[model samples]
Target: MGTSINDHVDRRTFLKYGGAASISAIFAGCTDNQSTDETTNESGTDSPDSTESDGGSTSNGDDEATEFNYVTTVTPSSIDPMKGSDNLETLLLHNVYDPLLYYTDGTPPELQSWLATNYSVSDDGQTYTFELRSDATFHNGDQVTASDVKYSVQRMMDMQNGFSWMWEGVLSPENVEVVDEKTVRMTTNDVYAPFLYTLPFLYIVNQDQVEANANSDGQFGEHGDYGTEWLEANDAGSGPYQLASRERKREIVLEKNDDWWREFPHGQDGYEVVSAEMVQESATAAGRMREGAEMADQWLPLQTYNDLANEDGVRVHAKATFNPFYVYMHTQREPLDDVHVRRAISYAFDYDAALTDVMSGDSDHLQGPLPGAMWSHTDDLETYGQDLEQAQAELEQSEYTASDIDLEYTYVSGLTVEQNMGLLLQSNIQELGGSLSVNKAPWSNITEMTTSKESTPDMLAVYLSFSYADPDTFLYPAWHSNSHGSWTSASWYQNDEVDDLLTEARRTVSQEDRVPIYEQAQRIIAEDAPALFVMNQATRNALSTDVQGFKDNGITGYRQTFHRYYQG
Candidate 1:
């Protein structure tokens, strides 16, 4: 018998590159109509018990709502399911699209069925078969079937962009097969342990709609543009909401999908409409929240959240996330290529100032690559702290002198916290006799610059997030040699020993076997100091007190699924 395994954007310049710098929220409460079946899969990674939802607090009753207003700083680059990879794009596409499985809370194991009722893994841990939910239908009212699932996988693999890195070497289009109208099977080339964790990223699309809308640009061969052009502003999904309109740099409006597969579990009369307004300035977003905006984006500083909470109608919700804010050093670049230099820079970072001053003590200091909240995070791992003496000592060990250290740090523009972080690093590095120049770039330009080694800056400030809560989600993609050229791996660090350890961890299905392997990798990576281990973020969002049933959806980059929000 097969066992069950459950799991859980950008555009243009973002497309040519892979992922983006994400500083992205959580969902709680209310179970949808989910299958109760407990099918066993071939022994794979252990998963949490299947839950409709782990259960969140719900309101007694709610009045009919006109719309739920949400304010954010960044703009979604593309709505195409396979094209966009940033938090802004995810905040939009996640509502407009449905993944096979949903990561509702903390880790990959805390998954609930979405489009797929349940899935089974083969004996060798290479093949997975999913049973499609019959009631699931795309926005155009077409029934979702096995073919759509297959096509979605094929398209994701074909584009080879965005979150495609999740499946890069493990899966291919030829590996996905439609067994029947409702059953789809996928076979990986290896026993990829994180395979299950990558499912929530496979946002299904209407195969027919894509083909009908495809143009002959030949970007994707016979698939033409594969509906990328059409999907840029439009959505072809079976999610809880449908894209009503997308205004560039303004807002993306979404209306509830009445025909959605799952009904609201709580006494939640979900919002009628959702307006994701793009408000770049934190003060403006806070102002709008005071003026009756239901929710504010996650980018606001800690003080802003506290101020909003003091208001009569506003409350703050915070959840510790696995998203680690990083100061990635280009390991392939000169000065930074030296491990001593990297370690020296890491020692010079002001961790206390970052946590207390810049982040306002909201986030936990990260131990290593993995956040402390993660299951297998190395608790005893020695992490960096502000020690100028140690910094100078490490610098002395480097081939280059302190005077030779001239570096540039780049961060996303308009983010007050990141700017402060850059300034703090600049000051600390200066104390070590190194000059560090701080610069800001728009999110789009940052994504474009990080695409290649030549254009990438010596140091970059970005928050790296995982779609699913697995060690591989952080280790493999963020540090592996093959994963370079993307924002997450912009550090460009490569270690054969660490790579072999991570590879073994991926192949090892059992959590017990994988933990030590992961820990070893963490230790090696931390010693290398390719990136400054700043802190794991605690995301705080302001919401109107009337907005009830809000839960932290575990994955970073993905915001709260608006379907759970209703005015009480």
Candidate 2:
């Protein structure tokens, strides 16, 4: 039986890469169905087409009454679902595309059928058969078929980019068989435990639409880049909305799909357009909010959130998330390579101060990689709190004295909160008789430096959320030797014992049996101190008071469907 959605298991207690405080008065004086005349874009440009009096356009009794403006810091690398990697890209793809299995925020959280109406798993747990919904159709008015599923999977494998790692050892082109027009069968190489959880990422694209837009000189033969070039600005899905226009890092506009298969969840009185403006600067986002500009309806950072809390017509909603922030201590480096030194650095830093002062109490101190929400999370693990004495003692045991070594602490530039946290760490490390230099760089530079161990700094602060809900998603990618050199596992810490344990746990079919193995692995990694377990972020967003039906789910965080929200 699937877990009940209402199971409030408080196993332990956390942003994507983001900070906080209280203002209960923010929600006061909120009026229903308030309409704004003009909507401001993130670049401080006025969207002339967005001046509809009803907040959205309507045609022939079509119930298009609202237009929700959402602001984000990140930009989509690509509109193609298979190529999406970051939160912004995934957010756009989720609304524009439909996966076979849709993840829902139901009590006991479950995978709800989307394109596929029903599915069956073989007794061996290796074969999965799915029956597509007959009524489902792509945005271009093409009927969805089993062949489309096969084509999509084959295309993803052929491209070998983005989420290709999902099917690495589990599935191949030969395993995806179209039994009939509406039925498809998928066979895996092994008993993959997270197969169902990973399905939501496999968005089914229209085979015909993609082929029609293929370029002759594209990367893929015949398929011609698999319509990637065309998909960069267009969408090929049958979701609630369709792409109208995209300005790369500036803004993306999605218009309501009037011929959508499923009715709007909240009925006909929903938004007809969703505008996602990219506001990279938190200060700019805050300024827009303070001025009561209709630039964004939802999704703002803690810095902007705090600034808007006291402002009238703004409502602040915060929810604990599974994403955890960490300070990766590169084990390949000189002083950080020593376990004692890593432990000393972990103990010396003040976790509470970082969460309270730096983060503004918008997060919880996390002891390990796994968040408290996961079933395999072990709460008994030692949480290395602030202890200067223990830190000094651990440093004394290291081969090199603190005074003899200088360390570089790197953080993503433009993030004021992260800069503050880095400075705090520098101060903490300085007290241990070491000279620490704080380096600020763009997120792209940090990602580039992590590609090689030689370029990786002594300590790197990063905010990472799980791609899937499984423990392997957290452990293997962040700790396994295979993940070394990747930004996710910048520490370059490798242990044969940990690798074996993670392998065993992943291969184990029974969740009950896998718990102990994962628990053991967690303990081993925690003791190694390759990364400082900082905190699990609490996603804090400031929404306009008139916004309604916006429920924050821990798993999806801010990447929610605009259809779920409506102007009150």
For each of the candidates, the C-alpha root-mean-square deviation to the true structure, in angstroms, is 7.4, 7.3
| Predicted structure 1: clash tally | 22
Per-model TM values vs. the true structure: 0.87, 0.83
- For model 1, residues 246-353, the per-residue Cα lDDT tens digits are 888888899877777776443234577889898767889989999999988777755666566667788776555455778899999889999999999888988987
Candidate 1 overall lDDT versus native: 0.75
The whole-model lDDT of each prediction reads 0.75, 0.71
- Residue-wise C-alpha lDDT for candidate 2, range 1-568, written one tens digit per residue: 2222221221111224443222121222322322222133333221221333332333314544467777665555567888775566667888888888765543224456778877887878788888888988999999999999999899988986556666766788789999999999999888877787777778889999998988878877877789889998888898878999988778899998877776565544567777887777767777765655344423343445555666788766655566677889889879888999999988999888887676655567887877777778998999899999999999899998988658888976555556677888889988888878988876556666887889987889877646665777778878877666567788998899998887777678888999999999999999999998887765556677776655543344333567555556
- Over 4 Å off, model 2: 1-65, 214-224, 290-303, 360-362, 396-405, 442-458, 482-486, 557-559
